[model samples]
Target: MEYIDPHLHMVSRTTDDYETLARMGCVAISEPAFWAGFDRGSVESFRDYFRQLTDFEPKRAAQYGISHYTWLCINAKEAENVTLSREVIAMIPEFLDAKNVLGIGEIGLNKNTRNEATIFLEHLDLAVKYNQQILIHTPHLEDKYQGTRMILDMLMGDSRINRSRVLVDHVEEHTIEHVLENGFWAGMTLYPVSKCTPQRAVDMIERYGPERLMANSAGDWGPSKPTAIPDLIMEMKKRGHSKELIRRVVYENPKTFFSQSKPFVHG
Candidate 1:
């Protein structure tokens, strides 16, 4: 079953991980700009990181026959440095036209602070200005609910945003309804710890019925699995889900959402 891992930080992954993903049927992946485990001090650091994402990572993925797409932003954790965030956002335009570039993403609230909200709105503005699609990261654990709400409110308040073009990721049982019911796509990240597991993700599919919903590995430098989507495929099959139904969640759904980006030319 061929699939797409829509949100993963390949920069933190190894070449062996890429090989393993390809072996497990991952044909394409979209990496979102995220905090590099620490706060970066300057816009130049982000500029260099963007270059790595747009220029280097794609080439690396290509070695394994995987198409790599990317999103740019100063991630919420770093967005607290409002001045630096704005500078990084302003510099993102230089890479938007890159063939592998998707749009502004993995952009949403972390701690749901005022500065985070301000930077979130500014990233929204950048997305709107570029007519780009968005990929959002809701907060973790206890902060997830309110952070998701705050992110949604800001997005809903923006008149220029087309809800369908936005994806609110890391949704759990409590927050998935709000994202999908509001007309935006929702993503369930399968993780070994913290986020939804393969069984839990399959349960969400049973409840939500897979419309405008997708699953990802969210594989990064932390305790995550790059092959989690494949695990999800097996779980769905074991639960008697038809191949077509499982395909819709692991493959078709992401293709549909990511196709909205001009640079994402479906093959």
Candidate 2:
């Protein structure tokens, strides 16, 4: 069963991740901008980071028959430092025109604080200006329910953004309805900890029924493995989900979401 991980952070992963993912029938992935596990001190840092995403990783992924796609935006946790976030946002256009760039993403509130919200709105404005698809990373743990609500509200208030073009990610049982109810695409993160696990991801599918949904392995600077995409695929199969269901959730949904950025991919 071929799959696409709609979200990942390949820049922080090793080549072995590519090999394992390819062997698991992974065909494509979308990576969102995320914290580098430390504070990046300069705009040049982000520029280089985007370069790595567009240039370095794609070549490595090609070796394993996996296509690498990325979303360029300043992560919300780091957005607390507004100045740095703006600088990173400014540098996004240069990379957005790269061949593999999907859109502006993984940008949303982390601590669910006011400043992070402001930065998230700014990021949304940038995405709208470009007519780009958005990938949002909502808060986790205790903050998730409210943060997911806030993220959806912000998008709804923005007359310029279509709810269908936004992917509210890392949703769980509690937040899934809110995302789907608003007609926005939902993304489940299959991680070892601090997010939904593979079993729960499949359960969510069973409970909610898939539509505008995608799953990803938010593998990154932490204890992450890129194989989480295939992990969920396996779980879905074990749960007796049909091939069409898996295809719609993993491959077709992501393709349709990212294809909205076709101009960016060619520009």
Candidate 3:
């Protein structure tokens, strides 16, 4: 079945990876700005990167019939550099009108530091001002629970944020309940190493019933499988899930959530 991988770093993947995604039924993807494996020294580095996201990557994905969309923000790892993070957040608006641009995101705490929360709220301010849909990256492993709580608290404190337009991604069993119960969408990142596995993702779907949930490969520079969403489909089928139910999680859920963005015109 055709699907959308809502979170992946295509810039870190090869053209062959894109072809494989096409063959595996990935019709579109949304790439969020993330750490480049290092701290960038200046805002100019981010400007160039945003240009690549809004310009280069989409054309590259089109070669294999995959629509590309992007979200812009200095990730939490870099957000500790408050001065630099503010500069990057200020510069993000220049690219907001790009046809493939989605919103300010994958923006949440990494170490759950004070600086990270400050920058996260600032990015939230930017998104609310622009009326952009949000895509959040919750903390990993041990930090996931508290960081998600902090994020939800921050989001709740801001009355301007529309809960339904935001997606808190990388949710596991411990964190998914708060995300969905509070009226925000959740994403299960299917990875071979960390985050949810394909089977665990299917488990969440069974338990939660796939109302406001979706799955992603989160393919990046690390050890992650780009076609993990298809694995989720196979797992759901293996457990005797109806194709409609499987498609609702992998394809329709993301498409519905992302449709809230004006630049995401792909159906």
Candidate 4:
């Protein structure tokens, strides 16, 4: 079935990967800015990276007939540098008008530090100011719960934030309930090594029942699978789930959430 992988870092993948994704039924994808293997040295580095995301990556994806949308932010791991973070934030406006640009996101706590929180709030303000939708990244491993909570509290505190316009991603069994209970959309990132697996993602879908929930490959540089969403589709099939239910989770849910964006024009 055709699907959308809502979150994947194509920058880290080969052009052959794009061909594989297209062949596997991935018609569209959204790439959020994240850590680039290491801390970048300056705002100029981020400037070049954003150019790559906003300019180059879209063209690359187009070669395979995939629609590429993107979110811009100095991801949490780099948010520790308040001065540099602010500079990147200020510079992001230069690319907001790009046809493929989505919004400010994958912006949430990493280690849940004070600086990260400060930067997170600032990114929120940027999104609100621009009337843009948001995509968040909750911390992983043992830090996931508290970091997710902290991110939620900050978002809830802001009256300007329309919860439906935000998607808190990387949710597991423990954190998915909180994200959905609070009225925001949730994304389960299917990974080969870490995060949740295809079977466990199906378990969450069974429990959650697919209203404001979706899944993604989150394919990136690490030990991840670009075709992980297809793995999820296979799992749902193995469990005797209907095609309607599978389509809602893998395709419609992301289309609905991304419909709020200025640049998301997928058919």
Q: Give, for candidate 4, the lowest lDDT window spanning 10 residues.
A: 189-198
Off by over 4 Å in 3: none
Tens digits of lDDT, candidate 3, 192-214: 76788999888888898889899
lDDT of 4 by residue, 113-174 (tens): 99999999999999999898999999999999999999999999999999999999999999
Over 4 Å off in model 4, which ranges? none
Best candidate according to lDDT: 4
lDDT of 2 by residue, 20-76 (tens): 888888888888888998988999988888888889988998899888888888888
At residue 240, what lDDT does model 1 achieve? 96
**TM, every model:** 0.99, 0.95, 0.99, 0.99
Superposed by TM-score, candidate 1 places the C-alpha of residue 237 at a distance from the truth, in angstroms, of 0.6
Clashes of each: 0, 0, 0, 0
Per-model CA lDDT versus the true structure? 0.94, 0.85, 0.93, 0.94
Model 3 local distance difference test score? 0.93
Which of 2 and 4 is ahead in lDDT?
4
Residue 179 accuracy (lDDT) in model 4: 97
Order the candidates by lDDT, highest first — what do you get?
Answer: 4, 1, 3, 2
Return the TM-score for candidate 1, rounded to 2 decimals.
0.99
TM-score of 2: 0.95
